[model samples]
Target chain A: MNLVGSFFGSSIGRKIIMALTGVILIGFVVGHLVGNLQIFQHPDHINGYAQFLHQLGPLLWVARIGLIAAALLHIWAATVLTLENKRARGGDYGFKHTIQATFASRAMRWTGVIVLAFLVYHLAHFTLGVVQTETFKETAPLNHYVMQNDYRVAGFTVVKAGTDVANVHSMVILGFQHKVVALFYIVAVGLLSLHLLHGFNSLFQSLGLRNAKWSWLLHKAALALCVVYFLGNLAIPGAVLAGKLRPQTAKVAATAQR
Target chain B: MTLRVWRQAGPKALGQFKDYAAKDLNSNMSFLEMLDVVNDELTLKGEVPIAFAHDCREGICGTCSLTINGKPHGPGKGIATCQTYMRSFHDGDIIVVEPFRAAAFPLIKDLVVDRTSFDKIMQAGGFITARAGSAPEANAAPVPKGVSDLAMDAAQCIGCGACVAACKNASAMLFVSAKVGHLGLLPQGQAERDRRVLAMVHTMDEEGFGNCTNQYECSAACPKTISHDFIARMNRDYLGATLRSAFQPEAASSDGGGA
Candidate 1:
């Protein structure tokens, strides 16, 4: 069999697919968290950053395509492996017990499915501006007000104004201001983190990297990183809900009232 | 002591737990010894004895298979079913005994399953092909101590299906990895190391075994207490072997030294 055919045809090879794509997906998650962290900065900073991403044009599309492909392959491999595992076991034991498997390890597929759903809703809410249509900050009165903010890039002498940029800062703030939306984001990312708890360490074993000397550190690192990642995800929505974060338009309106 | 033992007339027969209570028991007796006494009473009443598989009554020979109270090879650490003694439990305790479960090891009778699947996997490439006639000089190879120790650890696998019985996925990766790692780590094993992993793993899949999810349950249940590191080693070997095979001819020279 060819590389593709061989990988897809066997049990171990399919798992290799999962580990390989898992690496890509993990990289994307870390990069995404770092980017989204900018929401804590001045509204103009996040808005300008969104504008800069748009300016990437085809490069952004390339990344999107790669991420989408990785996601698809990861899910596909997981589905195939799950079915094979079930079938391979044949009959259920009268009394089954878990020894070393963590609750997080057992619940990987459930969390993964929900995370995928959250990803879709998130993209619609933020990327496509389709969900929560009224809250979409790309149009109307909210966009006009927020556009008054100007972004100052760190190294540049001149300010890059947000006059033409969409108010991503306000959009995120408004969306998360709704208690339900903020809570859902927290819960979704919570599950994603739980999924990563097992997945992060498991990838090494799948790729044949785990060994006696490194196993302890790998497990500890997986636990630590997953916690940090979830906290980073929790912070944005948490801050928005707490009123620490406000759109530029809201900030401007508050200043005018004074 | 009271025992809740699984009883099935045949492979296709519906099996259920049948209670056997023996007031005259010895805590010093091995788990199988207690069963032997129970069988004696059953024979007096013309009742068919509870069926189980055993050999060597040892911790080493992996033939003795049972899941006692939901644990493979009973509760004792690093021991087989035959090594599990009745002393592990209190007198009058009702021990739940059942056959090792896996699709690959089909139930043949009450507690016996056809474990020939393991045999088939091992037959694929578990042995090194070197010489048939005489023992070679030990000094000629001069194997490294660390490498030999690692090989010895992998070689300790007793072809037991306890790992499969214990895994949520029923994965045979532990066994296959041990088999692969044992030979692959040695000089004699390198000649067919790549082919060994590929063939054994392929046969394992063909026999309807699952993939390892790194749960470490297999190692936990392993009678030998084999480390899970061998699975990762085998995974590396298998990946390298697959990529190499993809690039080269199927029947590449086995010399490993050939460029």
Candidate 2:
């Protein structure tokens, strides 16, 4: 009903929105992964990251709201465009699958829905202290911080010995140590990868940039990036569940107990 | 050899593909050349030679438009019926030729239809028109090779109407997109870009051409092999136009007319 309907009312308009929003979302995912990968740097590195995000105060809230709005607009536009396309098709008369569609085109709507659902679960598991240990937050009572990758600094650095906080770090470790939560995060990353692989290449085509010279390479690059991001995120959760790596504190406990 | 062709004397006239046998046919002739032989024989026999339109026996003009044996321009890519050799067909084969038929393209006489709508759409936005009486030097503008290539791709549309005939929905999105792309790419067209895209797309809708379903069949049937990329460009242009129009709504009630 907002900018989405008018934006997607015509074929050309829908393509523009799809391309623009797809690019935005892809950029967000890349940045988000880069931030999340800080967990591998050191356990406390993520907690430091969380505290940094918390320092932005109102600006961080504003950015979060802006991101939510963008994601909502993108999903709504895609749904409306798909619905209109279906209606234009006259209620899907006849099974013409093999005739007029590729595997990626056919799976677009389904993959989109799956990715949306996975996003909700992902935010709850990692970012929100709901459904997981509260230690993932910057202001947790203990210095057990788990970084969602993006953080703002409120003047707390590793150099300041007295500023040690355990809440945020412990939250991340406790959350990932739970095999179920880690598995869900791993699957969510997989779905995100699939969504990106199709979305990135499609954006260029929709924006009318499908030139013969660069099209093939652009498509290959987008797919490769998606795969890399998916595997990178999955690796963290996979390591935890497979017992390849335990929490840093847990490894210390094992040594002391043995 | 026999030629079976569809004939409808008028728009309201019921039509059928009637067979006519050819006597003393030369195998070493063009398909149209063979048709000429049949027509000459029919005239000698005091019958109306089958009504059809063709010009420039070569394939370039695109005026030699036809749907032969359910194939546009008779089964060869980048070639027309006038250039089609009789060697392509075997003895005793009955070839069926018919006029290009669509609601937008009304048949005139026999093979010719009023393709003036195409001319009209072109006139709407297909040209790069700068200010009048101020002719700038040809080299004043510097267009990159990629833009020129894209412009050329859209320019390749010969107005053959094969896209309309091939589409089940009878969409002219491909044809209209070509016209849009041809003009939109040039620097000279930037002045009227918004108006041009809006005018062309509006006219296309009014002409009763169906919306593109992204099926890519139109590209397949096109003799020029016009890509669906132009359609994508059209979509981009249309979106830009929508945003522009929203900002600056056109003045209504500007049409002054007498009672």
Candidate 3:
């Protein structure tokens, strides 16, 4: 086998792959959550943010491709490792008892599958606009370069036309307003939280980043990160379902059209 | 005391728990001695006695391995099956005894298992190619106190297979880590440190041992109380070895040049 192939074929090598890919995916989720949180600010804020990403053009596609690769690698490594573990176990114990493994750790595979399913549904609901509620309507593409008077690149004014700028702020609000969709999102986020709870610390361990001195602190940090992600992501649907967030006002939509 | 012991005729035979009453058992007797009493009675009655693995009954030998009441080496910590005493249990208490379970350690009989896999892993790379000679002076190499202490801590693993039985995934990571860390920490073993770790881990995987989940049950159930820290240390070393082997395969192949 080639050097790269043999390295990846080792158990530790596979774990390192999972860890690296996992960190990248976690970074994307945190960034996505922060971007989505702009829905509470105003319709212009999120729509403008969306337009900014659209204006990035090729750079956005690169990032999208990178994220897809990372997700695929993470899932692939996880599946191989899980299968190897099952084979290692050979068969169930005549009598079994667990001493230190937590519920989240034991259920990591199932929770991971749920998170993957949720990722697909999330992409369809907001990114593709294919799974929107009946009241949902697509917003016209924003010409962000022309719309933002202060937009600049490297101290120079750049004028460019932006296309396919869906008003994601309104879409998010409308989607969460549906009780079933909101509940599904909430449950999915819960499972994601469980996955992150075990996965975050596991990533550190798999990458050989943990030691006796730092293990406790790293575990706490992982738990805290999971909680932050859970609460932050959950707040959006919670607010929308409680009627605290409403669809874009007609005045706001009209101003964007101009 | 009521002894609930696992009974199996052979490797492929069906196993089941059979209860036996231990009448007139002395509280001062060791756990195995009590079993001996029960076996003596079974022999007098012309029934096949319960088969178990034991040697050097003082606990240094790793052979007397059993999972007692769902915990390897009985309920207490840092002691082997033979070291357990009857005084640890109440007079009327019911005890459950079974062999250590793992895919790598297949059942041979009632309580004996084929632990030759561990031996095979050891054979893969668990040694140094040092020349045999008269004993050298203790301070010949001048190892630091802390390094020797850490090496001693890892060297306590007796290959009892408790770690495998304790792990939910049946991972032998703790055992392999112990072996790797013990030798890798010593200056003399440095010649083959990288290669030894790689070969042993490879053999461990080949033996069908599961991957480490970092649950710490292995350390908890260890008869020698081997720490889980060794597993992390082994992981770090494994990563370093793999990367070095990938990028500098020729360099790792030298094996300290002289040796």
Candidate 4:
């Protein structure tokens, strides 16, 4: 076998793959959360941000493909390793007891499966526009232009034409406006938090980065990161359900008029 | 006291727990000695005695392995089954004992498992290929105190396979790590260190041992109190060895043109 193939076939090699893919996925999730948080900003800011991404065109496709590949590799490695672990256990013990393993560590596989299922639902709901929420509304592309002039002069502001917006801001707000959809997202993100809680430290260990000197710090960092992700993600749905976020129709109309 | 023990007549026989009552067990008796007392009674009654493996009765031999009440070597830290005393248990408590369970170590009968797979792993590379010569002076090749201490710590593994019994994954990474770290830290073991780690790890995988999930259960269950740090050390060594071997051909070819 080729060197790469042989390395990947080994247990440590597979673990390394899981770690690398996990890092990539974590980056993507963090980036996604950041962009989603823009819902709290002005409508023009988020819609323009979406337009900026849409203008990236091919670069956007590259990122999408890379994320899909990383997700697949992560799931593949996890399934294979979990199966191997199960087989190694031979049979059930008469009476089993856990000594040091945490609840998050024990629930890793189940949380991973839940997060994966949520990923599919999330993509279908927002990205594919397939699983429409109760508050779903079809939005048309709007031409965006910058009117940069002295704010003191109301009508004398200069309008510069820009690219069209995809109305992603409206989609996010309306999607989360549905109580059931928002509740589902809250639950899924909670599972994702659990998965990340155990996975970050596990990733370090799998990649041989864990040692007695750094294990304590690494575990604390992992827990902190999980909490950040959980709270950040949970905030969006919480904001939407509480009627704190609203569609930026007035701003969009003003931009169109300008 | 009520004793619940696993009973399997043969390698393929169905296993089950059989209960036996002990009337006069001294609290000062070690757990294995209590088992021996129970066996003596059974033999006197013309019944097949409980079959368990033990030698030296001390903790060093690694021969006496049992999962007592769902714990490897019973409920204590840094002590084997032979070191556990009946005093640790309440008088009316029911003590459950079973063989160490793992796909790699199959049950032979009762609490005895065929741990010869560990022997196979050891044979693969667990030794230094040294020349038989007169013993050299102790200080001829002095090792740093920290390195020697680490080596000694790793070398304490008795290969009892308690780590496998305690692990949810039944991973033997701790055992392989101890073997690899013990030798790799010594000067005499340097010549074949790379090959030793590669061969030992390959054999461990082939023996149907699971992958390490960094759960630390193996270290917790270890009779010798071996640390999980050795596993990480071995992981780093394995990566280095694999990469070095991968680039060895280019390195060899480049060496010919150097001079």
DockQ of each: 0.74, 0.09, 0.49, 0.58
Best by DockQ: 1
Residue ranges of candidate 1 with Cα displaced over 4 Å:
A142-159, A251-258, B249-259
> Sort by lDDT, best first: what order?
1, 4, 3, 2
Name the candidate, 1 or 2, with the larger TM-score value. 1
Local distance difference test values of all predictions, in order: 0.86, 0.67, 0.81, 0.83
lDDT of 2 by residue, A13-111 (tens): 655766787787778888877876776766556656666566668988987887787788688777765554343222111111122334555566677
Q: What share of the true interface contacts does each candidate keep?
A: 0.71, 0.12, 0.45, 0.56
As a whole number from 0 to 100, the lDDT of residue A60 in candidate 1 is 88
Highest-TM-score candidate: 1
- Residue pairs clashing, model 3: none
Model 2 lDDT tens row, B180-249:
8887888877888877887776666556555554556577777788887787777777776776767775
Candidate 4 lDDT tens digits, B1-259: 8999999999899999999997689999999899999999999999989998889788999999999999899998999999999988998899889999999999999999989989999999999888789898889888999999999999999999999989999899899999999999999889999888888988888899888877788999999999998887888788888888777766555767766
lDDT, candidate 4, A1-258, per-residue tens = 345864678777777788899999999999889887876866555655565566578999999899999999999988888899999989778877887888988888899999989999988887666776332233332333332222111454222234344566666766786799899999999999988888898887776778888889998999899899999999988987898776666664343333
Q: What local lDDT does model 1 show for residue B242?
A: 90
Model 4 chain B weakest lDDT span, ten residues long: B250-259
